[model samples]
Target: MLRTVNVTRYIQPLREGGSLPALAEADDDFKYVLKFRGNGHGPKVLIAELIGGEIARELGLRVPELVFAHLDEAFGRTEGDEEVQDLLKGSQGLNIALHFLSGAITFDPVVTQIDAETASKVVWLDSFISNIDRTVKNTNMLMFNKELWLIDHGSSLSFHHAWMHLEERAKSPFPFVKEHVLLAQASLLKETNEAFKKLLTPEKLQAIVALIPDSWLEWPDTDESPEALREAYSQFLITRLNHSDIFTNQAQDAREALI
Candidate 1:
């Protein structure tokens, strides 16, 4: 079960890349990336990441193992709003420290491209759930244990409301053919669809939806119950799964490539 933890010590920061307040563990017991809320330009960004990361895990995605943590006040101070701080404390500091994938490295989008089959699977998953984070520049995927591990889902779902408008709603916001790596490999969609169907059950989907904070939902006047939200999200998934040709094609392509 996912739970909160008390981080005892401060870890070294990873200087090369990453936009948030992230650090690498010093002790070798478990290499972890500690994401924190600091007094900076984007404190709310980290909070979004925590929620999205947990949601991805619940969806059966190959995300890193995550643990919600509390930073020692002595480490540093966060310049976030009181509401944000309260929300974090209410949700255990809104910090998600993920177990780092050691011996794994991020690849250039062109250098280590996923086969059309895998791309189809990934794109299908993202689209059904309204994930807009996995773009051409910021795929947020990793190669670990001879397989793909997805990371950094902070930019997905509720956080993407700003991009959602009348024009955007008319067409699929996620056009895999133009943006994803395996656009030409459309056949993988079938395999991905099957895998998604097997993993995303009504019960699991409900549980995950229930876990979402009421504060995250955009509709101010919409006082929908958690169960209602679950049902709605589930319907959304079913509708997209049935109608999305990209999902079907990509899953098939991915399955064939693996064979």
Candidate 2:
């Protein structure tokens, strides 16, 4: 289980995100950008951030530390804003806390020189997760201490939206990957494939999926239980990894056309 910290203060809202995540102070005395399970995208997005961000770290990407932040309803009583109060009240249990990177600047691919290997790995990883957030316009990357740090994966794993056709969707090709920020500079897809193909085995995939909180898995509309949903995501990632070469090739073609 991830280390849990108590949220002590609701600092401010980050209106940049569609879900409108907020900054807060935690018992750990560290500030965190808090993403609530009760947000518009719901808990699955948090699951995606957990699963996807961990995978990126396993593959040696720079990702901000993720911790589970506990919210107490009493904190809501202090907030004067009704909208933020409602969010705090609703998210009275566990939520996602991304360690606040105080001076990190958003990465602009045009002005930055990301190495081909790292760029390829990031692009390939996004393709695997079907993350559509890292475009030229919204890279979802931060440059801190002169290194790229990935963030905001609340929109990956689209197959989970329709679990009945999970396997079919997992095997389907990705057409949106062409616009990936790293695609144009991802010149080492082959090496990236060779390295991670051997790394993200079924056992590893299962372990990563298992990290998702059980509470995040249960939804009224879904007949599948929490464990079943975990299994579904594990299988989806493993299957998607098996078929990664398809998108790798697609990225190479996209890169050739762009550069």
Best by lDDT: 2
Quality of model 1 by C-alpha lDDT: 0.54
Model 2 steric clash pairs = none
Best by TM-score: 2
Off by over 4 Å in 2: none
Q: Write the per-residue lDDT of candidate 1 for residues 140-226, one digit (tens) a residue.
A: 788888778887655554423442242234234354324544444445566666776767665665555455443334343456664
Per-residue lDDT tens digits of candidate 2, residues 1-259? 5789999988899988887799889998999999998887688789988988888888888899999989886877978888877777878888898899999999997799899888999988898898989998999999999989999988888777656777777877777888888887888988898789998888888888888888898787887889888888888888888987887788778888889
